[model samples]
Target: QEELAKKQAEALKIQKKNDELRAREEQRHLAKNTRVFELPLSRYKRKDDLKDIAACLGLDLNGKIPELTSRIKAHLDSNSVLQANPRFCGLFG
Candidate 1:
Protein backbone atom coordinates (compact mmCIF):
# COMPACT_ATOMS: atom_id res chain seq x y z
CA GLN A 1 0.00 0.00 0.00
CA GLU A 2 1.05 3.69 0.24
CA GLU A 3 2.78 3.08 3.59
CA LEU A 4 4.82 0.21 2.14
CA ALA A 5 5.92 2.32 -0.83
CA LYS A 6 7.03 5.12 1.50
CA LYS A 7 9.00 2.71 3.66
CA GLN A 8 10.71 1.17 0.57
CA ALA A 9 11.65 4.60 -0.72
CA GLU A 10 13.15 5.59 2.62
CA ALA A 11 15.14 2.37 2.77
CA LEU A 12 16.45 2.91 -0.78
CA LYS A 13 17.56 6.43 0.10
CA ILE A 14 19.44 5.15 3.15
CA GLN A 15 21.08 2.41 1.08
CA LYS A 16 22.18 4.93 -1.54
CA LYS A 17 23.73 7.14 1.13
CA ASN A 18 25.53 4.13 2.65
CA ASP A 19 26.93 3.16 -0.78
CA GLU A 20 28.21 6.70 -1.39
CA LEU A 21 29.89 6.77 2.01
CA ARG A 22 31.55 3.39 1.35
CA ALA A 23 32.87 4.55 -2.01
CA ARG A 24 34.38 7.68 -0.52
CA GLU A 25 36.04 5.67 2.26
CA GLU A 26 37.51 3.25 -0.28
CA GLN A 27 38.92 6.14 -2.34
CA ARG A 28 40.53 7.65 0.75
CA HIS A 29 42.09 4.33 1.75
CA LEU A 30 43.48 3.80 -1.75
CA ALA A 31 44.99 7.30 -1.87
CA LYS A 32 46.67 6.78 1.51
CA ASN A 33 48.18 3.40 0.49
CA THR A 34 49.40 4.51 -2.96
CA ARG A 35 53.07 5.19 -3.74
CA VAL A 36 54.30 7.15 -6.76
CA PHE A 37 57.68 7.36 -8.53
CA GLU A 38 58.75 9.56 -11.42
CA LEU A 39 61.64 9.44 -13.93
CA PRO A 40 62.75 12.28 -16.18
CA LEU A 41 63.27 11.77 -19.94
CA SER A 42 65.48 13.93 -22.07
CA ARG A 43 64.11 17.17 -23.42
CA TYR A 44 64.20 17.94 -27.19
CA LYS A 45 65.11 14.45 -28.37
CA ARG A 46 65.39 13.73 -32.08
CA LYS A 47 65.75 10.64 -34.29
CA ASP A 48 69.35 10.43 -33.15
CA ASP A 49 68.24 10.14 -29.52
CA LEU A 50 66.17 7.06 -30.29
CA LYS A 51 69.02 5.56 -32.23
CA ASP A 52 71.47 6.20 -29.41
CA ILE A 53 69.10 4.83 -26.80
CA ALA A 54 68.54 1.72 -28.88
CA ALA A 55 72.26 1.31 -29.21
CA CYS A 56 72.89 1.69 -25.50
CA LEU A 57 70.03 -0.64 -24.62
CA GLY A 58 71.16 -2.99 -27.41
CA LEU A 59 67.62 -2.94 -28.87
CA ASP A 60 67.25 -3.31 -32.60
CA LEU A 61 64.31 -1.15 -33.74
CA ASN A 62 64.76 -1.41 -37.54
CA GLY A 63 64.19 2.42 -37.68
CA LYS A 64 60.57 2.13 -36.56
CA ILE A 65 59.45 4.98 -34.29
CA PRO A 66 56.74 3.13 -32.33
CA GLU A 67 58.87 0.11 -31.60
CA LEU A 68 61.82 2.31 -30.75
CA THR A 69 59.84 4.37 -28.27
CA SER A 70 58.30 1.33 -26.53
CA ARG A 71 61.64 -0.47 -26.30
CA ILE A 72 63.34 2.58 -24.83
CA LYS A 73 60.56 3.05 -22.30
CA ALA A 74 60.76 -0.61 -21.26
CA HIS A 75 64.52 -0.48 -20.94
CA LEU A 76 64.33 2.67 -18.85
CA ASP A 77 61.78 1.05 -16.59
CA SER A 78 64.05 -1.68 -15.17
CA ASN A 79 67.40 -2.08 -16.95
CA SER A 80 70.07 -1.30 -14.39
CA VAL A 81 72.77 -1.40 -17.03
CA LEU A 82 71.08 1.35 -19.01
CA GLN A 83 70.34 3.28 -15.83
CA ALA A 84 73.95 3.01 -14.74
CA ASN A 85 75.39 4.08 -18.11
CA PRO A 86 76.51 7.68 -17.77
CA ARG A 87 75.50 8.52 -21.33
CA PHE A 88 71.99 7.06 -21.22
CA CYS A 89 71.48 7.93 -17.56
CA GLY A 90 71.65 11.59 -18.50
CA LEU A 91 68.88 11.02 -21.05
CA PHE A 92 66.57 9.61 -18.34
CA GLY A 93 67.54 11.80 -15.42
Candidate 2:
Protein backbone atom coordinates (compact mmCIF):
# COMPACT_ATOMS: atom_id res chain seq x y z
CA GLN A 1 0.00 0.00 0.00
CA GLU A 2 2.88 2.38 0.71
CA GLU A 3 4.52 1.59 -2.63
CA LEU A 4 1.25 2.16 -4.48
CA ALA A 5 0.82 5.50 -2.79
CA LYS A 6 4.33 6.59 -3.78
CA LYS A 7 3.73 5.59 -7.40
CA GLN A 8 0.49 7.51 -7.45
CA ALA A 9 2.21 10.59 -6.10
CA GLU A 10 4.91 10.37 -8.75
CA ALA A 11 2.32 9.96 -11.48
CA LEU A 12 0.49 13.01 -10.24
CA LYS A 13 3.69 15.04 -10.39
CA ILE A 14 4.38 13.89 -13.94
CA GLN A 15 0.86 14.67 -14.99
CA LYS A 16 1.10 18.17 -13.53
CA LYS A 17 4.36 18.79 -15.35
CA ASN A 18 2.92 17.64 -18.65
CA ASP A 19 -0.06 19.91 -18.17
CA GLU A 20 2.21 22.89 -17.50
CA LEU A 21 4.32 22.19 -20.60
CA ARG A 22 1.20 21.89 -22.74
CA ALA A 23 -0.12 25.20 -21.47
CA ARG A 24 3.20 26.91 -22.15
CA GLU A 25 3.29 25.58 -25.70
CA GLU A 26 -0.22 26.85 -26.31
CA GLN A 27 0.71 30.32 -25.04
CA ARG A 28 3.76 30.45 -27.31
CA HIS A 29 1.66 29.44 -30.32
CA LEU A 30 -0.87 32.15 -29.52
CA ALA A 31 1.81 34.80 -29.14
CA LYS A 32 3.55 33.82 -32.39
CA ASN A 33 0.31 33.89 -34.34
CA THR A 34 -0.75 37.21 -32.88
CA ARG A 35 2.48 38.91 -33.97
CA VAL A 36 2.77 37.29 -37.39
CA PHE A 37 1.66 40.24 -39.49
CA GLU A 38 2.15 43.22 -37.21
CA LEU A 39 5.67 44.25 -38.20
CA PRO A 40 6.34 47.95 -37.82
CA LEU A 41 9.40 49.52 -39.45
CA SER A 42 10.02 51.81 -36.50
CA ARG A 43 10.60 48.90 -34.14
CA TYR A 44 13.92 47.92 -35.76
CA LYS A 45 16.05 50.99 -35.22
CA ARG A 46 19.53 49.48 -34.98
CA LYS A 47 21.46 47.01 -37.12
CA ASP A 48 21.64 44.58 -34.22
CA ASP A 49 17.89 44.66 -33.95
CA LEU A 50 17.54 43.65 -37.59
CA LYS A 51 20.15 40.95 -37.10
CA ASP A 52 18.13 39.49 -34.27
CA ILE A 53 15.02 39.37 -36.43
CA ALA A 54 17.00 37.80 -39.27
CA ALA A 55 18.43 35.15 -36.99
CA CYS A 56 14.96 34.28 -35.74
CA LEU A 57 13.74 33.97 -39.34
CA GLY A 58 16.74 31.76 -40.22
CA LEU A 59 18.03 34.26 -42.75
CA ASP A 60 21.66 35.16 -43.29
CA LEU A 61 22.61 37.75 -40.68
CA ASN A 62 25.66 39.14 -42.51
CA GLY A 63 24.23 42.15 -44.28
CA LYS A 64 23.49 45.88 -44.09
CA ILE A 65 20.32 47.06 -42.42
CA PRO A 66 18.48 47.64 -45.69
CA GLU A 67 19.45 44.19 -46.96
CA LEU A 68 18.42 42.54 -43.74
CA THR A 69 15.15 44.42 -43.76
CA SER A 70 14.34 43.26 -47.27
CA ARG A 71 15.25 39.67 -46.46
CA ILE A 72 13.06 39.65 -43.36
CA LYS A 73 10.19 41.25 -45.23
CA ALA A 74 10.41 38.69 -47.99
CA HIS A 75 10.49 35.81 -45.55
CA LEU A 76 7.53 37.21 -43.62
CA ASP A 77 5.55 37.73 -46.80
CA SER A 78 6.10 34.16 -47.90
CA ASN A 79 5.21 32.79 -44.50
CA SER A 80 2.08 34.90 -44.33
CA VAL A 81 0.96 33.53 -47.67
CA LEU A 82 1.47 29.96 -46.48
CA GLN A 83 -0.32 30.71 -43.21
CA ALA A 84 -3.27 32.33 -44.95
CA ASN A 85 -3.88 29.20 -46.98
CA PRO A 86 -5.97 26.67 -45.07
CA ARG A 87 -5.10 23.82 -47.46
CA PHE A 88 -1.36 24.24 -46.99
CA CYS A 89 -1.69 24.43 -43.23
CA GLY A 90 -4.00 21.39 -43.09
CA LEU A 91 -1.47 19.29 -44.97
CA PHE A 92 1.24 19.79 -42.34
CA GLY A 93 -0.81 20.96 -39.36
Candidate 3:
Protein backbone atom coordinates (compact mmCIF):
# COMPACT_ATOMS: atom_id res chain seq x y z
CA GLN A 1 0.00 0.00 0.00
CA GLU A 2 1.02 3.60 -0.52
CA GLU A 3 0.74 4.33 3.20
CA LEU A 4 2.92 1.40 4.14
CA ALA A 5 5.50 2.43 1.56
CA LYS A 6 5.50 5.98 2.90
CA LYS A 7 6.03 4.81 6.46
CA GLN A 8 8.79 2.46 5.41
CA ALA A 9 10.53 5.25 3.55
CA GLU A 10 10.28 7.49 6.58
CA ALA A 11 11.69 4.76 8.80
CA LEU A 12 14.57 4.20 6.42
CA LYS A 13 15.38 7.89 6.46
CA ILE A 14 15.40 7.98 10.23
CA GLN A 15 17.59 4.90 10.39
CA LYS A 16 20.03 6.45 7.94
CA LYS A 17 20.17 9.67 9.95
CA ASN A 18 20.88 7.76 13.14
CA ASP A 19 23.60 5.76 11.41
CA GLU A 20 25.27 8.93 10.23
CA LEU A 21 25.15 10.45 13.67
CA ARG A 22 26.59 7.33 15.25
CA ALA A 23 29.41 7.28 12.70
CA ARG A 24 30.21 10.90 13.44
CA GLU A 25 30.30 10.20 17.14
CA GLU A 26 32.56 7.25 16.56
CA GLN A 27 34.96 9.42 14.61
CA ARG A 28 35.04 11.91 17.46
CA HIS A 29 35.61 9.13 19.98
CA LEU A 30 38.43 7.66 17.92
CA ALA A 31 40.04 11.05 17.46
CA LYS A 32 40.09 11.58 21.21
CA ASN A 33 41.08 8.04 22.18
CA THR A 34 43.48 7.05 19.43
CA ARG A 35 47.09 6.60 20.52
CA VAL A 36 50.27 7.15 18.52
CA PHE A 37 50.79 3.43 18.25
CA GLU A 38 47.39 2.98 16.62
CA LEU A 39 48.39 4.99 13.57
CA PRO A 40 48.26 3.32 10.16
CA LEU A 41 51.47 1.69 8.99
CA SER A 42 51.43 3.87 5.88
CA ARG A 43 51.76 6.94 8.07
CA TYR A 44 55.24 5.81 9.02
CA LYS A 45 56.85 6.86 5.77
CA ARG A 46 60.43 6.54 6.92
CA LYS A 47 62.26 3.37 7.79
CA ASP A 48 63.17 4.71 11.17
CA ASP A 49 59.53 5.43 11.92
CA LEU A 50 58.57 1.90 11.01
CA LYS A 51 61.45 0.57 13.08
CA ASP A 52 60.24 2.48 16.09
CA ILE A 53 56.74 1.12 15.68
CA ALA A 54 58.04 -2.39 15.21
CA ALA A 55 60.13 -2.05 18.34
CA CYS A 56 57.18 -0.91 20.35
CA LEU A 57 55.09 -3.78 19.01
CA GLY A 58 57.85 -6.20 19.97
CA LEU A 59 58.31 -7.14 16.31
CA ASP A 60 61.61 -8.09 14.75
CA LEU A 61 63.45 -5.01 13.51
CA ASN A 62 66.03 -6.80 11.41
CA GLY A 63 64.19 -6.64 8.09
CA LYS A 64 63.80 -4.07 5.31
CA ILE A 65 61.13 -1.42 5.38
CA PRO A 66 58.57 -3.47 3.46
CA GLU A 67 59.38 -6.56 5.45
CA LEU A 68 59.04 -4.74 8.71
CA THR A 69 55.77 -3.26 7.62
CA SER A 70 54.35 -6.63 6.62
CA ARG A 71 55.51 -8.25 9.85
CA ILE A 72 53.98 -5.55 11.95
CA LYS A 73 50.74 -5.80 10.02
CA ALA A 74 50.65 -9.55 10.46
CA HIS A 75 51.28 -9.28 14.18
CA LEU A 76 48.52 -6.76 14.60
CA ASP A 77 46.11 -8.86 12.55
CA SER A 78 46.82 -12.11 14.37
CA ASN A 79 46.81 -10.59 17.84
CA SER A 80 43.81 -8.30 17.37
CA VAL A 81 45.67 -5.68 19.36
CA LEU A 82 43.66 -3.04 17.55
CA GLN A 83 40.36 -4.91 17.58
CA ALA A 84 38.50 -2.52 19.85
CA ASN A 85 37.71 -0.04 17.07
CA PRO A 86 36.88 -1.35 13.62
CA ARG A 87 37.56 2.09 12.21
CA PHE A 88 41.06 2.01 13.59
CA CYS A 89 41.46 -1.53 12.35
CA GLY A 90 40.56 -0.44 8.82
CA LEU A 91 43.27 2.19 9.02
CA PHE A 92 45.93 -0.49 9.32
CA GLY A 93 44.27 -3.84 8.74
Candidate 4:
Protein backbone atom coordinates (compact mmCIF):
# COMPACT_ATOMS: atom_id res chain seq x y z
CA GLN A 1 0.00 0.00 0.00
CA GLU A 2 2.81 2.44 0.85
CA GLU A 3 4.61 1.73 -2.44
CA LEU A 4 1.41 2.22 -4.40
CA ALA A 5 0.73 5.56 -2.77
CA LYS A 6 4.30 6.73 -3.47
CA LYS A 7 4.03 5.77 -7.11
CA GLN A 8 0.69 7.54 -7.46
CA ALA A 9 2.08 10.73 -5.90
CA GLU A 10 5.09 10.61 -8.19
CA ALA A 11 2.88 10.22 -11.23
CA LEU A 12 0.72 13.13 -10.20
CA LYS A 13 3.75 15.37 -9.72
CA ILE A 14 5.06 14.47 -13.17
CA GLN A 15 1.68 15.13 -14.72
CA LYS A 16 1.48 18.53 -13.08
CA LYS A 17 4.93 19.48 -14.34
CA ASN A 18 4.03 18.36 -17.86
CA ASP A 19 0.85 20.41 -17.81
CA GLU A 20 2.74 23.52 -16.75
CA LEU A 21 5.31 23.07 -19.49
CA ARG A 22 2.62 22.56 -22.09
CA ALA A 23 0.85 25.75 -20.99
CA ARG A 24 4.05 27.76 -21.21
CA GLU A 25 4.72 26.44 -24.70
CA GLU A 26 1.22 27.33 -25.82
CA GLN A 27 1.63 30.87 -24.50
CA ARG A 28 4.85 31.31 -26.44
CA HIS A 29 3.24 29.95 -29.60
CA LEU A 30 0.31 32.34 -29.29
CA ALA A 31 2.62 35.29 -28.66
CA LYS A 32 4.58 34.41 -31.78
CA ASN A 33 1.51 34.33 -33.99
CA THR A 34 -0.05 37.52 -32.63
CA ARG A 35 0.08 40.48 -35.01
CA VAL A 36 0.17 44.05 -33.85
CA PHE A 37 -1.09 46.92 -35.95
CA GLU A 38 -0.73 50.65 -35.59
CA LEU A 39 -4.04 52.35 -36.19
CA PRO A 40 -4.27 56.06 -36.72
CA LEU A 41 -6.54 57.94 -34.35
CA SER A 42 -7.86 59.75 -37.37
CA ARG A 43 -9.49 56.52 -38.39
CA TYR A 44 -11.80 56.95 -35.46
CA LYS A 45 -12.90 60.27 -36.85
CA ARG A 46 -14.70 58.27 -39.48
CA LYS A 47 -16.96 55.97 -37.51
CA ASP A 48 -17.61 53.66 -40.41
CA ASP A 49 -13.94 53.26 -41.24
CA LEU A 50 -13.07 52.55 -37.63
CA LYS A 51 -15.80 49.97 -37.37
CA ASP A 52 -14.66 48.33 -40.59
CA ILE A 53 -11.06 48.11 -39.46
CA ALA A 54 -11.98 46.79 -36.05
CA ALA A 55 -14.22 44.15 -37.58
CA CYS A 56 -11.51 43.07 -40.00
CA LEU A 57 -9.06 42.77 -37.11
CA GLY A 58 -11.46 40.58 -35.09
CA LEU A 59 -11.71 43.26 -32.44
CA ASP A 60 -15.04 44.06 -30.89
CA LEU A 61 -15.42 47.79 -31.08
CA ASN A 62 -19.16 47.31 -30.48
CA GLY A 63 -19.79 50.82 -31.85
CA LYS A 64 -17.83 52.23 -28.95
CA ILE A 65 -15.06 54.49 -30.24
CA PRO A 66 -13.58 54.99 -26.78
CA GLU A 67 -13.35 51.25 -26.16
CA LEU A 68 -11.54 50.81 -29.46
CA THR A 69 -9.11 53.53 -28.48
CA SER A 70 -8.49 51.83 -25.14
CA ARG A 71 -7.81 48.49 -26.77
CA ILE A 72 -5.30 50.13 -29.10
CA LYS A 73 -3.60 51.78 -26.16
CA ALA A 74 -3.46 48.53 -24.21
CA HIS A 75 -1.96 46.63 -27.13
CA LEU A 76 0.67 49.29 -27.67
CA ASP A 77 1.56 49.24 -24.02
CA SER A 78 2.44 45.51 -24.09
CA ASN A 79 3.94 45.36 -27.61
CA SER A 80 7.48 46.09 -28.80
CA VAL A 81 6.46 48.00 -31.93
CA LEU A 82 5.18 50.91 -29.89
CA GLN A 83 8.54 51.20 -28.17
CA ALA A 84 10.39 51.20 -31.50
CA ASN A 85 8.10 53.71 -33.20
CA PRO A 86 7.52 57.06 -31.54
CA ARG A 87 5.50 58.01 -34.59
CA PHE A 88 2.99 55.36 -33.63
CA CYS A 89 2.17 57.17 -30.42
CA GLY A 90 1.50 60.39 -32.26
CA LEU A 91 -0.53 58.66 -34.93
CA PHE A 92 -2.72 56.90 -32.42
CA GLY A 93 -3.04 59.78 -30.00
User: Which candidate has the highest lDDT of all?
Assistant: 3
**Model 4 misplaced regions, further than 4 Å:** 35-93
Across residues 1-89, which tens digit of lDDT does each residue of candidate 3 receive? 99999999999999999999788555544544333554666777777666666655666768888898889778877877666755346
Indicate the TM-score of model 3.
0.48
lDDT of 1: 0.61
In Å, residue 76's CA in model 4 sits off its true spot by 22
Mind sharing the TM-score for model 2?
0.43
The TM-score measured for candidate 4 stands at 0.37
| Greater-TM-score candidate between 2 and 4 | 2
- Model 3 misses residue 6 by how many Å? 86
Alpha-carbon shift of residue 17 in model 2 (angstroms): 42
Off by over 4 Å in 3: 1-35, 85-93
TM-scores, all models, native as reference: 0.43, 0.43, 0.48, 0.37
Candidate 3 colliding pairs, count: 0
- Residue 15, model 3: Cα distance from true site in angstroms: 65
Please write out the lDDT profile of model 2 over residues 9-36, one tens digit for every residue: 9999999999997885565445443334
Write the residue-wise lDDT of candidate 4 on 18-71 in tens digits. 999788555544543342435565555555445444443455656567777666
Query: Each candidate: RMSD to true structure?
Result: 15.8, 11.9, 13.9, 12.7
Write model 1 residue lDDT over 1-93, tens digit each, in one string: 999999999999999999997885555445432322123554525654465446545677465766777777777787767556555566566
Q: Number of clashes in model 1?
A: 0
